[model samples]
Target: MNPETIRRRRWYILGVLTFSLLVVVLDNTILNVALKTIADPQEGLGATQSQLEWAINSYTLVFAGLLFTFGVIGDRLGRKRVLVAGMVMFGLASLLSAYSQSPAQLIGARALMGLGGAAIMPQTLSIITNVFEPQERGRAIGIWSGAVGLAIGIGPITGGLLLAHFWWGSVFLINVPVIVVGAVLIALLVPESRNPDPGRLDPVGVLLSIVGLVTLSYGIIQGGERGAWLEPGVLGPIAAGLAVLALFARHEARSDHPAFDVRLFRDPRLSAAVAAIALCFFAAAGMFFFAGFYLQSVRGLSAFQSGAMLLPFAVAQILFSTRSAAMVHRFGAKAVCATGLLLVAAALASYPVLGIGTGTPLWVLGAVFFVQGAGMANVMPPATESVMSALPREKAGAGSALNNTARQVAVAMGVAVLGSVLASIYRGELAERLAALPPGARTVAAESIEGAHAVAERLGAAGQGLIGPANAAFTEAMRTAAGAAAVIAFLGALVVLKWMPGRTAHREPERAERAERAERGTGREKARGRRAASRERTRV
Candidate 1:
């Protein structure tokens, strides 16, 4: 497409990009509400807890593993081509998942969906960077980021509504129509862009990255499932993954045509922005993981109610994200990010207080969600803009990949670490109560709050005693996890305050204006001298 034509349709193109992103983001949150139904043997797939975990982990592993590789490929190939192909693959995988007869089938289909998602994600951000002017990029990105918040809030509610009327497959089936429409709009409105000087492929770096990320993600997922990290299954893979990633970094630094440019980290803007994103997501993802259990298991709310409670969060995102660019313009990225992280810390800190008892008002929890969402809305746009601005437009795909990779890795680590903390604390608190039960029952009940509830149901009258202790133990675990998350968020605030640049609006533009004035003055002086010389020659 021509430049003017692309400019004229940029807003429409952005809408299409956001719609495409919704399919990927919406699927994960929607699946959360379907887990219980999917676990039912008669109603849905008779998947065990381990199988269910794999259904999620399989997708996460594949998505995180191939994200950067696909980003590089998008830069070399055409972004529009990759994006359309991804949407098609994702739609087909959704169909397969909807018709899946077994947990294994669903897991396999989800992996294919992940492959498609990896292709889709980086292209959206890169395309936005290419299409929007620098001055408008932040505003555009804020809208893009808000779409994520919208998806999070709506996914469970959508799943609940679908499941109420139809089968478990309805959740997956819902993605098809959206994907089809988005694909068509993308073809019509979105312009194709690629790096004109995309260098040769780095197959070796690509292999190392996939191996390292998949192994690391597996280790993290395994650690969360096992609720321990010291064992060989967890530690061995983590160690191997780290070593391979180190090698990948070394190779990329030396390669003539690197798959990912390691030297980008040298720019403080890029590095700090990446750290802010990683840390923010790390804390947020862990909190969200546990919040579901709290709302449903502890508070006795249904899936639909829990989903409705998140509307405050969604509202906050919609209200604040679109205006964050103005905040950044006034206060600067460093101020906005640090203040936002502080708000996130404050919200996380409230979790321990609000989660003290099952009787705690739901409104209080909703208020906390609002604060957290608002904080996140302020942080993402500025950080993302900073990351994109640090690199030339041609390298936007790589930059987008780096931003997303950091988030994905941090999410894995957060879930693993915080989940481990929750499990340990819960088991310790419930140990005495569990010991009174039969050996197998005690083991199962000690595994998780849900497992405890299952055991209690089986024991009937005798198991009624387990419910109170289980709820108390789980609440205590949640408090501890929230506290830890609060600390991480506070640390993120400190990191941004120290490293992110301060108040560039007043200084950089002023300097440019001064330079322009000086050049104009010099031009005028030269013109006067030329006129004087011409007059003197004519008089002679």
Candidate 2:
């Protein structure tokens, strides 16, 4: 497409991109509400807890693993081509997931969806970077970030509604229509773009990165699932993954045609922004994981009700994210990001105050969610702009991949680390109470709040006594985890404040104006010299 056409239809193109992104992100969270249903022996597939975890982790591992590879592929081939192909793959995968005969089939299908998601994600951001001018990119990115928040907030609610009306598979099936519509709009409106000078393929680098990231993600997921980081099952893969990643970095640094340039991280703008994204997500994802349990198990709210309660968060995200560009324009990225992180920290810190009781008003939790959402709204757009701006437009795919990979890795780490903390604290608090129960019941009661609740229901009168202590222990654990997350978010704020550039939005115009003035002054001086030379010639 021509530049004029692209400019004219840019907003439309953004809409299509956001729609496509919504499905991918929505899928990430949508499965949460369906996990209970999918575990039922009669109503759905009888998936074990471990199988359910794999249903989620399989997707995550594949998505994180392939992101960089697909990003490089998009740059080398064509972004539009890759995007359409990914959407098609995602649609087919969703269909397969919906119709899967068993848990194993669903896991495999979800992995295929991840493969498509990786292909779709980087291309969207790169295309936006290429389409919008520097002046408008921040606003575009803010909107894109808002869509992500929207998807996350709605995913569970959508899943709950689908499961209520249809089946557990309906959550996966819902993506098909949306993908079809997106594919049509994408074909019609989105233009193809690629690197003019994409370097030669680095097969070794790609292979190393895939192995490193997948192994690392597997280790993290295993740690979370088992709640044991030091076990050989967890520690071994993590160590090996780190070693492989180190080798990958070394190879990239040495390669003549590196797939991902390790050198790009030298820029503080890119590096600091990437750090901020990773840290904030690390903090937030943990909070989200525990909050779901708190809402459902502790408070006795249904999945649909819990999902509805989070609407405030989505509202706050949409409102602030759309306006964050203006905030950045005024206060600058550094101020905005630091302030945002501070808000997130404050929100996280407030969780403990809600306490362990059902008496704690739900509205207070909603308010905290709103604040957290607003804080995140302010952070993402500025950080994303910084990442994209640090790279040449043609390298936007790599930059996008880097930003996303940091987030995915951090999310996995957050869930693992905070989950372990929660488990340890809860087990300690409830150990004496659990010992009073039968051996089989003791193990079940000690596992998780949900498990304790299930055992309570089964015991009838005997289980009634177990409920209060389980609630208390889980609440205490949640509070401690939230406090830890707050500290992490505060650290992110400090990092942004120290390293990210301040007030560059204002300074950039001043620098440009000064350059223009200098050019004009030079032109006038030459004009005067030419006039004087002409006068001298006439005199002669």
Which number leads on lDDT? Answer: 2
Candidate 2, residues 459-522, lDDT tens digits: the string is: 9997899899899898898899999999999999999988898896435744665788899999
Full-model lDDT for every candidate? 0.83, 0.84
Q: Name the runs in model 1 displaced over 4 angstroms.
A: 40-53, 221-224, 505-540
Clashing residue pairs in candidate 2 are none
TM-score of 1: 0.90
**RMSD list, candidates in order:** 4.0, 4.2
- Weakest 10 consecutive residues of candidate 2 by summed lDDT: 504-513
Q: TM-scores for all candidates?
A: 0.90, 0.89
lDDT of model 1, residue 263? 86
Task: Supply the global lDDT for candidate 1.
Answer: 0.83
Which residue ranges in model 2 land beyond 4 Å of their true spot? 39-53, 101-103, 217-230, 353-357, 509-540
